[model samples]
Target: MTARDLGLPSRVPAPGLPERVTIWEVGPRDGLQNEDAVVPVEVKLEFLDRLADAGLTTVEATSFVHPKWVPQLADAEELLAGLTPRDGVRYPVLVPNERGLDRALAAGVRHIAIFASATETFANRNLNRTLDSQMAMFEPVVSRAVAEGLDVRGYVSMCWGDPWEGAVEPGAVVSVGRRLLDMGCSQLSLGDTIGVATAGHVAALVNAFTDAGTPVSALAVHFHDTYGQALANTVEALRHGVTTVDSSAGGLGGCPYAESATGNLATEDLVWCLDGLGVDTGVDLDKLADTSAWMATKLGRPSPSRVVRALRG
Candidate 1:
């Protein structure tokens, strides 16, 4: 039987959910970066094409980080060069520093993302700097990108909980988020890097950001499904006025730096929830599920997305 046959509600019973939500698909970069085997550039390109065809408007194409760090996505330049840019589709690449920005700029990228951690331990481990220093490092990159008319997104990792530090205070996330916004990022994506957040935790963090004078509209949520709370947390964020969400196709991401973190909230799963709520995401659920299932073949594993698995069954 199909999902529709299951008699799911066409719209959510709860009020206050946005009529439309923007989903930023991060499978191409974050999803593939931690893979044990190298995915050929051609396969990566095809995966991107399928994702775009599945109706994702904002697809993070690749990261311009050092090849040594993320060898799976070493072909960022080639991937960007080979893409057939679609009208109304935005492709953003991750840029670690001015050097990565230079590479992205050279590759003709128009949108880039810079990431910082809310906790000191994650900051030191991931960026090899303190929280303050990491913010300082991204300042120049954000400034240069804005000056060049490139869309910039800032990611604050470990927004809810940290592996070493445990139970992160929302205030610390707010401070880093405010700095990133002040640095000229068009949007800030709050990440539950270890997927330890519950719905209540999600609500508190969103409220904290708004209480600190940061517009909820400028914020996005990026959650991992480790504790099985990603969808619940996403619903809480949406109810709290956050309209942008970051997800991966086939649930294909895990933070390499934070080894305990699991796969990201799947694009298919998110789309299914939104579709049932009568929320518009401009994404075709069946197409996305099929695309992910196809990618599973390339990755030599079954897709982790429940929606994809159900559709395939």
Candidate 2:
């Protein structure tokens, strides 16, 4: 059935309209990046293919970080080289620096994502550098990628709270977001790395960025389910005109630096929420649940996505 058939709302009636929420599935990269058991290259490729087949247009394909840091994705080059390119899907890789950008270029990556943090402590812990240093490094990488005809996406982590520092200021998020946008990033994804944000916080941040002259259309929200608020926060973001969300299949991720936080909002769960709200996601809920379940079996762990478990019954 189409979204209209599902009795979901197509558009909000306010002066601002959140046309459609774009779901960028990150199961292949953020979901599996920290798994203790290394997933095989073929398996990763198959998982990505399944996501594409399920109608995901944007997928975070992989990361080009150091193999020593994340050995699970040590086969980044081989995986990128072997992916069967789909006609309309955009597969973007995460590049932490110029070295990663060079590798992505050599491997024919057409889109790349860079990450920065809002807090100095979280920035140092996650990226091993101060916020300014991280921005300085990514500025040229973003420019070079854009010059080469690649779409650049920038992720600003710890928009809500930081593990080392508490209560990240909204202005801090805006500062990094503006720099990323000015540096030639096509989109800026604000991430609640530790998942401490509430719906109120979500609305506040989205408005803060918009009021600062960054278009709401250029901003996306990424939330962890640590506090069970990702979905609620996503709804708040949509109401405020932020239309893009970053999610992982099976809810399969957690911050390496943030203790006890779970994955981003599950893609299946997000699809279900949007479907119920009459929002068009263009994703098949049952197929996504099946894929997440199959991956859970392969990993010998319970699928973290709530919709997946509920649908399996």
lDDT per residue as tens, model 1, 1-313: 6764553326654578989999999999999999989998898888888888989999999998998999988888888888989888899999999999999899999999998999999999999999899988999999999999999999999999999999999999999999999989989999999999999999999999999998899999999999999999999999999999999999999999998999999998998898888789999887888899999999999999988887774
Ten-residue stretch with the least lDDT total in model 1: 4-13
Each candidate's root-mean-square deviation in Å?
1.5, 3.2
- Which residue pairs clash within candidate 2? 8-278, 9-278
How well does model 1 score by local distance difference test? Answer: 0.92
- Model 2's alpha-carbon lDDT is 0.87
Q: Kindly provide the TM-score of model 1 when superposed on the true structure, using C-alpha atoms.
A: 0.97
Model 2 compared with the native: what TM-score?
Answer: 0.94
Please identify model 2 stretches exceeding 4 Å from their true place. Answer: 1-19
Model 2: worst 10 consecutive residues (lDDT sum): 3-12
Angstrom error of the Cα, residue 132, model 2: value is 1.2
| Model 1: pairs clashing at backbone N, Cα or C within 3 Å | none
Best by lDDT: 1
Error of 1 at 14 (Å): 3.4
- Cα lDDT tens digits, model 2, 151-225, are 999998989998777888899999988999999999999999889999998999988998998898899989999
Candidate 2, residue 255: how far the Cα is off, in Å: 1.5
